[model samples]
Target: DAMVIQNPRYQVTQFGKPVTLSCSQTLNHNVMYWYQQKSSQAPKLLFHYYDKDFNNEADTPDNFQSRRPNTSFCFLDIRSPGLGDAAMYLCATSRDNGNTEAFFGQGTRLTVV
Candidate 1:
């Protein structure tokens, strides 16, 4: 069974338009992470919520924002998506902050037009 679920597997948004990608998990994991991956590149950690505590990566752009209202849900909001912002957004969940096996969603492929 899929523990982590990301909705709208493929999304197309116009340039400068805002879009939000959602993820929900059944595992009740404490850590939920959002990553951005470009073609042939490694996934970059955008941010994560560790049980209500939000942690953002230093290099993450201001255009990206995230919300974790509760344990099961998390959302990534792109304020003004540019062409370069198009990527595959992956949602992951882990039991803890320490080294642990993480469950990943199928991911949402975003296209900025």
Candidate 2:
């Protein structure tokens, strides 16, 4: 079945170091989003690309950034992952707005050392 995929199910990085988490999908969806979730907290929308239109959440940290070079691929880059940056990074995709449902990847668990 078509779905989202996140690489390196877990990532370990030192404080103030850069890291990149990847996400891709076979769903052929028009929108892809990156979310940061800590423990049992609600997933926080970082940013998303809707057919190349990048929409960033107002509360997303400056240390976080995203890129989508094409339809089925997207990436999350952390300029400097802090101790608090340690969290589960999820990638999700949706067909369109309104009546669409999002599918999530297994997620990359980031651990700041």
Candidate 3:
């Protein structure tokens, strides 16, 4: 019962190239989040989209973008990815904005060369 699914466990992209990672959830959670985790570092919140509302973290760069077409699907787009962008992109879903438990996908590892 995989509630959250992220496609293509691994990916590689050239510098300045664009790449898209996808996630889908079956739990129908109200909040969907995207996070970037570098090696041995904490996962940094990139953005979260819920109920048609999108929230981006202040420190997130312009190169990162996210789209939540519906409750079940979300996509993370990296435009002109730099070497610094290489990391694991994690997709998570929570029942609501409150202190509900969150379910995370296995994550898509992106390599920017």
The candidate scoring highest on TM-score is: 1
Cα shift from native, residue 101, model 1 (Å): 0.7
Writing each residue's lDDT as its tens digit, candidate 3 over 1-113 gives 88999998999999998999999999989999999999999999999987689999999999999999899999999989999999999999999998899899999999988
Among all candidates shown, the one with the greatest lDDT:
1
lDDT score for residue 37 of model 1: 96
lDDT of 3 at 104: 100
Each candidate's lDDT (Cα)? 0.97, 0.93, 0.95
In model 3, the clashing pairs are none
RMSD of each: 0.5, 1.0, 0.6
Error of 3 at 60 (Å): 0.4
lDDT of 1 by residue, 22-65 (tens): 99999989999999999999999999999999999999999999
- What would you estimate as the lDDT of candidate 3? 0.95
Steric overlap count per candidate: 0, 0, 0
Q: Per-prediction TM-score, please?
A: 0.99, 0.96, 0.98
The list of candidate 2 runs beyond 4 A from truth reads none
